[model samples]
Target: MSKKVIHKANTRGHANHGWLDSHHTFSFARYYNPERMNFGLLRVLNDDIVAPGMGFGAHPHDNMEIISIPLSGELAHQDSTGNKKVIKTNDVQIMSAGSGLTHSEFNNSKTDQVNFLQIWVFPKEQDITPRYEQKTFNPADRQNKLQTVVGPEKDAENIWINQDAWFTLGSLKTGFSEDYKLHKTGNGVYAFVLEGEVEIDGEKLSKRDGMGISDTENVSIKASSDAELLLMEIPMR
Candidate 1:
């Protein structure tokens, strides 16, 4: 049997600070829900929209695998490691805050708001060398299919992370269905709907809804309409 939990879009914690609007899927900052603390090694999932020319100042982090996926507009990134870049939609960025690092992100466009997802995962090991990587993926590659964006492997395609985890994105047409097998045993999959509607193993989810499924080897996904989906597979232990 599989264990599952659903987090409806409206149930997420919301914070509006004029320049930054954020939604938390787990306990973060001022949001405190003991039951919604984490999904295995996946610690944070934040959906954020930043006003043009506004962004987060420098902040420090250590011993964590952080990932950013821009949904729309452009995000300017700067880190203590001397990396500066602009990421737009279809780009995936990962930062391994192994020992320690300070970074900040801002909306690159002065006339447009930037929307992105910020994710944090607990590292497999602590206190190593910090690193940063960013890649732009072709949207057509995920059309009616899943595209691996980040994983634990070193390759020209996917960005590497400090944990035994894989992040995949899917762009599905209405009536499309697919089976997503677990990359490793004992790993769980968290499916987050980015747009449209989807049904995962018979459970329906709308835009921004999240579902954590564990104790299972695979999952069946069907699109009720044209949809964008994000799947994060991480170790449960």
Candidate 2:
């Protein structure tokens, strides 16, 4: 049997700073909920919208696997590793803050606001060499199929992270369906609804809603409508 945990879109922690509005799916910054600290090794899932001409200043992170995905507009990124680039839609970025690093992300468009997801997962090992990687995914490739965007295995076409995790994205037409198989036995899967509607396992999820399930080999995803979804399989311990 499979167990599930749910996070409703409206129940997430929210913070608006005039220039930036953020929603935390899990406990983040000043938003603390002991029960919502994390889902297995998946620590932070933040939905952020940065206003035009406004962004976050440089900050520090260490021993965390950071992944950034832009949903709209452009996000300008800079880091102490000397990696500076602008990421737009379909672009996924990973930063291994092994030992330590300072980074900043800003809205690249002076007129258009930027909306993105900033995720944090605890690394399997600590104090290794800091690194960064970014890849562009074709939306067509994910049409009706799960596209492997981040995983432990290095891919010529897909991006990989430093942890024992697998991340997939899918865009489905109305009434379409799919099954996502877990890569590791002890890993739990987090299904995040990006847009439209879907049913994961047996739970219906709308935009920004999330569900976590574990102790299973595969999860069923059926699109109730045209949908964009993200699946993350992460270690339980």
Model 2 Cα lDDT, one tens digit per residue, 194-224: 9999999879999999999999999998999
Q: All models: lDDT?
A: 0.96, 0.94
1-237: candidate 1 lDDT, tens digit per residue:
999999999999999999999999999999999999999999999999999999999999999999999999999999999999999999999999999999999999999999999999999989979999999999999999999999998874899998899999999999999899998999999999999999999999999999999999999999999999999999987
What lDDT score is found at residue 23 in candidate 2?
100
| Alpha carbon deviation, residue 136, candidate 1 (Å) | 0.5
Clashes per model (N, Cα, C within 3 A): 0, 0
What lDDT, from 0 to 1, does candidate 1 have? 0.96
- Candidate 1, residue 31: the lDDT equals 96
List the candidate 1 regions with Cα displacement exceeding 4 Å: none
Per-model C-alpha RMSD: 0.7, 0.8
